[model samples]
Target: MGRPRLGITSITLVKTLFLAALDAGAVYFAVVLAWQGSWGFLSFLLLGAGGVNFLLLSHKAYPLRYLFPGLFFLLLMVVVPVGYNIYLSFTNYSTGHILTKEEVIRVLTSREYAPTPPVRFPFYAFGTPEELYGVVLWPEAGPLLLWPDGRLASLEGHQVSDTDADGIPDVLDGRPRLSGRELLAHYGMLQALRVPWENGWLRLATLREFGYFLPQFLYDPEQDMLVDQRTGIQYRAGESGFYSPDG
Candidate 1:
């Protein structure tokens, strides 16, 4: 009588169980890397190698010579990348560190903005039924509305002229006007505008020409600090995190 033999079904079941466990582990690590978003290229290379390894290991009848070629490919894919990463960790590698002089200069220079004399003003919003609108400036100078003709209304000094017969100034030259939803259809062109605010400026922060966003805090590069205009406090960045300027 032949020795008792294990069924082929049992062997297949064992293979399936091993592959399932491998797949679960791969999925768990992938999720962790995705959440961190820092693994960078190594994550992609490993996932590819894992796929190839699965394919090779599942083939039950491969000769040893064929296995050597697959093993070589697997090493090339996995081992080479890890060696490269270990090499990079010891070198000077950072945003500006790797950059050439010209590239570094270009980046450093692009962050500057025109320090226009600060202009601050109190702004009120006017919305139209068509989702278009404009801002009315009070105690400053004029009203800037998104005109139906795809132009900006010059209501600044026109606080007296009745350009429109709606009992309001045709523009700012007349009297403060109410051009809310009535003029919303033209708001598509009402891109964000940087209007002079009190000693500084108020920026239109939306495409709809609605809300205003002011730089409530000022960043001083000279001192490497951020000053909160509202709270009258300064903060600085450091190795631990942002901390009060006093510390």
Candidate 2:
């Protein structure tokens, strides 16, 4: 042998730190899985992570690392999905009903419709371009103040003022609002925002406006059917996993 390595060498220290970080992430995900009631997937994750950790730590199991990567991928990608598909075969799983009854109802009821002559609100952002603190919606009705965290506040409480008199409020709660090119940087966060409006929601419709929308379908649990508000047609869930028009 050329040289013998010490137990607590720099390479060993780096390995220890890497493993500790990996374990921390595993614990965090394990807690999330437990909270979400994903027990089977959680068990697989715990067992797989535990095995990897043990194999890497124990000197006797060093040789297994060469074969471990392939085995891990095989079980995770191929075995788990195959097992889940087999489990689904016993139930009424098909194209339309891939999800549970409650899930299907939730999806249908969540669909939205944009009203004719849509009320488009011009809004302005507050805080740094990288991250937004709040926004002011200027609809014809009135001014509305809202935060990215999904909380709405009164415009009066924010000490609002239009410094440049550009129609869009320039200052709110002591923060100068972002405009033009600066506002574009906050696109990722703003796109996913949904604010409750009337009986439905108002969402980011374009770069310049937030559009008000209404619920497209109303789910009646007592009748187990979805009623289309626009067409006034009722569609009932059938055994074939599709919602056919009620006769």
lDDT of 2 by residue, 74-124 (tens): 988999899889988777564444687788778878898887878789888
Candidate 1: tens digits of C-alpha lDDT, residues 1-247 = 9898879888778867877777777677777777777587547746664764566475553465367676777778998788888888888762236766445334533332323343334444444354334455434344555333334456544334555675443434222434544544544444434444334444443432233334545666677666665566876656533368578
Measure candidate 2: CA RMSD. Answer: 10.2
* Model 1 alpha-carbon drift over 4 Å, by segment: 1-136, 140-160, 163-167, 171-182, 203-214, 245-247
Can you give the lDDT of residue 49 in candidate 1?
Answer: 48
Instruction: Supply the TM-score for candidate 1.
Output: 0.37
TM-score of each: 0.37, 0.58
On TM-score, the leading prediction is 2
Error of 2 at 56 (Å): 36
